[model samples]
Target: MNLIEKAASRINQGDALSADTAALRSQASPADEPPHAPLVQRAQARAAEVPVHAEAPSAESEQEIAERHVSRQITIDLERLRAAGMITPDDDKHQLAEEFRLVKRPLITNAVEATSSDRNRNLIMVTSSLPGEGKSFCSLNLAISIAMERDRRVMLVDADVARPSLLGYLGLQAERGLMDLLLDPNLQMSDVLLRTNIDKLSILPAGRGHKHATEFLASESMSNLLDEMANRYPDRIIIFDSPPLLVTSEARELAAHVGQVVMVVESGRTSQDAVKEALRQLEGCDIVNLLMNKGSSTPLDGYGYGYGYGYGYGYGRSGRS
Candidate 1:
């Protein structure tokens, strides 16, 4: 029997395979008779388990699929990425890349923990105390780094309604996305997602910025969209490049829908007071991870190695009451 035949046999016998269990038995010889008929029977049996009235898949349009992917995908320059200290799987182990790997661990853990009632744990928002604090840099890099993982897909959303920069950063043109979905009831998510050549990374540009952006962010439609994105795929990490917390109401409003928040603090540039106030704006978030960017580097100290970056993560302790 073939691989499918063994699977069919297992299913027919009412034997469920465990996560670690091998899919097929080696004893099944290639010369064995075709088990196609048995496999169909097994599949039919499994289909019987689903509710007969369960809703069918949404009939998403071809336009939706087409618009999601552009005629040409923007090829990220490897040398530019390396010089900018961004993560690329092909490059040698970089210090910045290593630091981000450590940076993403806790967030990934929170995303996977089923016990947590919050569905937005995987929906992470990256913002800053103010502009030029490296939040965009951090957001892009974080998404790329996470996408490098074999098991995870990254959906990087440009949520900076006030200043949408991801398209420029990625060397792409303006495209419809998050805001468009909210404004137009006819638009589906697949209608605006920009499919990149990057193995597992996709971009969702912040559509035409709305005048009442904050109101749109906190709308019921926005909530539904977020839920759909969160549950559509279990292995996705949705990263939002949000506007500066202190500058835009949309950022503060966006925080309400996210399970985790990453506040970027420019080490030498951002003031302590600004950082405190920026964090204060995200008062309702249960988990806020403070990422200190542009910090001074030190030589190996008592710990045998000096850590260049700083991060603070917690539940409601990050100015989130």
Candidate 2:
């Protein structure tokens, strides 16, 4: 019998395949009597257990997906997450809001918790080992988080010269940014810094793309710019959204100036070796912490035939509390 038939027979006999198990075994063989039918049935059976209200398999507009993502953010709660060990009790989102006041409040809590400390490491840079690892998302949230800190000024700089993303993420105008400041060393800091809607938070966007972007960041002007910002705003936190280490040398150069580097690793996508190599490549700054996104599909998985998080099932927020 084919794998699906084998699986069905096994299930009927009260020995079902694990839901979390890999699906590669179910791929149909060339000699199968009905090529894709059995595999489809197996996929259906597996999908039935999850109860997801997914979109039909069809092309979707990018705007629709972006809207859906933004809507999902409203449901994430601090107390619920803390119970799941996703965040600490004291570091819960609500508790953090009380301590810090800033616009786009959720981003701030995500940053503070991921970094795990408020003292010492405030000039933050959020980056990844490679592209599409959620570095921009991490950087934006961190800047928002530091701004939320009561009576603190925060500046979010879009320093990803190669490919700037913060403007698009925030849906902001791409007119002027850090590139302008670098090109015109005489430009006053106030001219380049754009204050966001968030109280006490400012942004220095990637002003304009230039051929010598890497050399610009590596220059003495870069050091002077950072030093000027540091001295000008003593209590404010500066967050630099830099390019991924493996993708470019921007992260290494920026890390040298920042107080701490918070590396973002997409839970399922980021390889352990890539993470180790990224750390090795940029060897000096304090690695503030590692933020594992989409953290652990099943935290209790991998142990052979053992009970899961809550009595062989997942835990609710109430259970977590």
Candidate 3:
């Protein structure tokens, strides 16, 4: 079999899940339509239209890779992630892991659909009302879960330039990334991308934090980067682990370029006012999903992370609590 096909074969033979939330699957509507508040400005659902052609070869094109930086492969501590209640292929039956599956299903459905969204619909940003609400935890697991999918490859970008925790969490070394390209025109994408041991996962660290991180995120260079990534590979899904809306202006800036946003709310601590404020900051977004993290009870007892996962406005999903 060809390389990608071979990889897919291995993954399909290796994935399954379980999570606790009372509604994990029990409250799921027979119809997949998620229960979410009406969007302020919904992007035109161009479900039937095909994308226009680009002039240059796409980012993931073989010809482009010929001159691009060779991606360096790295490994993650699957055991560590699992112990913390994150999703792991070795133990997909774990509640946290299973919960993540349900979380990603609808997002993946929207992402892979054939259409031209307000922006790149496949590009999803994961953030929270404030830091310490488990945005990173959810972002990492969501990326891993999507990567495990039989037909998709995932690119997880640590976009929280002010402070990035994804690389550290995955136990992978960090190098140049998003900001590096915007600041130094000489920097190529390959310099920052890390190909992980996971079959369909790759990552881009938040590079050196810039004093103008917010400005850099909204710069023309950043726009170009997102466009290139969106059209690069048909089977690819690009996810941004963004800064919290209440805490930084960067998340708002980043939101302008993506089609979907996911807000993570700490189960008991985050106030309703904070959630409303966070949503207000992302007022222009076409789609928004809320994931209730670290909820009241676990579906399965023995394991930890009482994060009862829920999907709302369609993408009530997140990583291990």
Off by over 4 Å in 1: 1-74, 301-312, 315-321
Candidate 2 TM-score over all chains jointly: 0.57
lDDT of each: 0.67, 0.53, 0.68
- The window of 10 residues in a row where model 3 has the poorest summed lDDT is 26-35
Model 3 vs. true fold: TM: 0.75
**Candidate with better lDDT, 1 vs 3:** 3
Supply candidate 1's per-residue lDDT for 35: 24
Task: Please give the range of 10 consecutive residues that has the lowest summed lDDT in model 2.
Answer: 24-33
Candidate 2: global Cα-lDDT? Answer: 0.53
Which pairs, if any, clash in model 3? Answer: 18-95, 18-98, 20-299, 138-319, 311-316, 312-316
Question: What ranges in model 2 sit over 4 Å off?
Answer: 1-121, 296-321
lDDT by residue for model 3 (1-321), tens: 533233223223321112233332221110001112222112123212426663533224342233222556678888877656667877766666667888788778777663653358788899888878777877888898888887788889999887888888766666788888788876666666787777778888899988988888888988888887887667888899998898789999999898777777665566767776776676677667677665545433656655455434332122211
Q: Which stretches of candidate 3 lie over 4 Å from their true place?
A: 1-69, 298-311, 314-321
- TM-score winner: 3
